[model samples]
Each structure stands twice: as C-alpha cells, then as structure tokens.
Target: MDKILINVLKEVQDNDGYISEKAMKNISVKYNVPLAKLYGVATFYAMFKIEKQGEHIIEICGSPSCMLNNGQKIEDFLEKELKIEVGKTTKNKKFSLYKTSCIGCCDEAPAMLMDGKPYTNLTIEKIKKILKKY
Candidate 1:
C-alpha cells in the first residue's frame, strides 16, 4: 500500500508539476487514506514538490563530500546569480534553486541535479556556462 501510494503521488506530481491541496484531497478521497498520511508521504520524499517549480530545477548537493569540495560556494553563487534564495523560483520563472542530499555523485563532489541531469565537479565558471545554456 505504501508503494502504491508513492506511485500514485509520483504520477500526479509528474502530470501536474506539483502536488496541490486539491489533489491531496482527491487522492485522500479516492484512496480512502487520511490527508495527513498522504501529506506525510509527499513531504517525506525529496522528489515530491508541494509547490509549483520553474522550468529548470537546480538541486545543490548538501552532502559532506560536496561541502568539502566547495558545494557551499557553488550554492552561494547560484543564489546570487539567479537572484533568488534556495527553495524559490526566479522572478522570470526560468529557474528554481534547492538544497538536496547527495545525488550519488560523491566521487565528483560539488555536484548538483539540474532538471534531474547531474552536473559534477562544479566551479563558479562551469555553473555560469551551464546557466547560460539553460
């Protein structure tokens, strides 16, 4: 049942871009699940977004390895360059920034997931170039 609930949530998020309060109610009624339970599941997973996101989502790695390799520096750069704080979308809606746990690129460190594509071994210069293309 947990797997089924997660799958349904994933499908809804994929189709709707985010999980809205109305959707949660619908899911609750349809599945006969408690709203709190559904909300808990959605919030527990990093992949589930409760708010609308920008065209490009930038999830900075917050692992110790990434931090040691200057991930904090990269995150600061992204916040400045994008002119928006983490967990927010830019005014132009072109990008959104977030801090997430390791993306399984500890080997590369300083890594991030942009629209689910991994960008590794980051530096300010490399990120500037990457943002330009996006």
Candidate 2:
C-alpha cells in the first residue's frame, strides 16, 4: 500500500506539480487509507509536494558546507530577484524557490538544483546568468 501510494503521489506530482488536497482526499477514499495517513506519507518524503509549485523549481542547498560557501547569499539574491521567499512560487507561476539540506554536492559546497539540474560553485553573477536561461 505504501508503494502504491508513493507511485500514485508521484504520478500526481508529475502531472500537477503538486499533490492538491482534493487529490489526497480522492486517493484516501479510493485506497481506504485515512486522509491523515496520506498526508503523513506526503509530508514525510521530501519529494512529495503538497502545495502548488511553479513551472520551474530552484532548490538551493543549506547544508553546513553550502552555508560556509555563501549559500545564504545565493538565497538572498534569488529572493531579491524573484521577489519571493523560499517555499513560495512567483505570482505568475513561472518559478518556485525552495531550500534543501544536502544535494550530494558537498564537494562543490554551494550548489543548487534548477529544475533538477545541478549548478555548482554558485555565485551571484552565475545565479543571475542561470536565471536568465530559465
């Protein structure tokens, strides 16, 4: 059941960019699992998104290594440029900014995942350039 739930949630995420509350309830009814249980599964996993996201996602790492490498500066730059805080999507729904612990790029220290593609050794100039591409 857990596997099925994960698969279904992934499908919803792939199609909707999030798992809407209505969808969760529908899945609960179909699977005979409590709504709370479904939500638990969703929230427990970092991959599952409950709220709405944008067309593009920017996930910046906040691990110790990243923090030491001016990761906060990168986050600040993104917030200023996008005018949205972490866990928020742009008003136009074009981009979303998020923070994560580690992305297995500790060797690079400061790193980010833009739409699931890794960008390492981030700098303000580089981030601005990357945003332009998106």
Candidate 3:
C-alpha cells in the first residue's frame, strides 16, 4: 500500500471508520502530498470508501442497462431479504447496501459487487450464496 493510504487507513481505523475532511487536509500537509492527488486516490478505488462501511459493503449497479435487466427487482429483493434499505447498514452492522451507477459490467446486468468482488447474473439463490461466503 502507498504510505499515504496506509496512514489514511490508520487514521480512519482510529476514528471508527470515518476520515474527517480536517484530518485529510492535515494528512496532505503533513505528508507533503497534493490534496487533489489524495482525493483522486480516495475516489478512484471502490474499496477505499470515504464514508464508514459495515463489515460487508454490497454495491448494486443501477445504470440504465442494468435497470432494464431487473436491477430494481434485485435491489428490492436485497432490501427485503436483508431487512435494510439502501445506504443503511444492517442492525448487526454486518452488511451495508449501496446502489451505484454503472460498474462497467453491463454484460452482467443485475450484478452486484460484494466487498469489491463482482457477482453477476444475480438471483436470490446467488445472493444467498454470496452472503454465506461473507
């Protein structure tokens, strides 16, 4: 990992998963790294979540192409099955549901990314399997 990212992780970990903007600015100044560069790195990786995440982050693609392929249905299923709404974590905080735009995997419409792993052609059964792995 990059030194800056490691430090950022440490800071976030120390603060219960949130990295304040003030802290980010401090990191930039202390490390002599550009703010824009740090921001870019933070935004570039789906894994680097700027906000707090639960133990598992479930990201469902909701682009037009995906929507046409029952993406909404999948989202609904997830909500109903997991008993949580998008942007909300589960009661146990083991999982968080997030609806994203395009994941650039339209060929696998109605797909979801679970903790950075892409699971395509999602079905309730498939989702169960994925959840089991977590």
- Model 1: per-residue Cα lDDT over 1-134, one tens digit each: 88999999999998999998999999999999999999999999988988888999999999899999999999999999999999899988899899999899999989999999999999999999999999
lDDT of 2 by residue, 18-69 (tens): 9999999999999999999999999999888898988899999989999999
**TM-score-sorted candidate list, best first:** 2, 1, 3
Segments of candidate 2 deviating more than 4 angstroms: none
Alpha carbon RMSD to native, model 3: 5.5
lDDT of 3 at 13: 49
lDDT of 1 at 97: 94
lDDT of 1: 0.94
Give the C-alpha miss distance for residue 75 in model 3, angstroms.
Answer: 0.4
User: What does candidate 3's lDDT look like per residue over 1-134, in tens digits?
Assistant: 36657667566646766555676687788878787887777666654556666788899998888889989998998899889998778888799999888888899888888988888988778888888888
lDDT-better candidate, 2 vs 3? 2
> How good is model 1 by TM-score?
0.85
Ranking the candidates on lDDT from highest down gives 1, 2, 3
lDDT at residue 44 of model 1 (Cα atoms): 94
The TM-score values for the models, in the order shown, are: 0.85, 0.87, 0.65
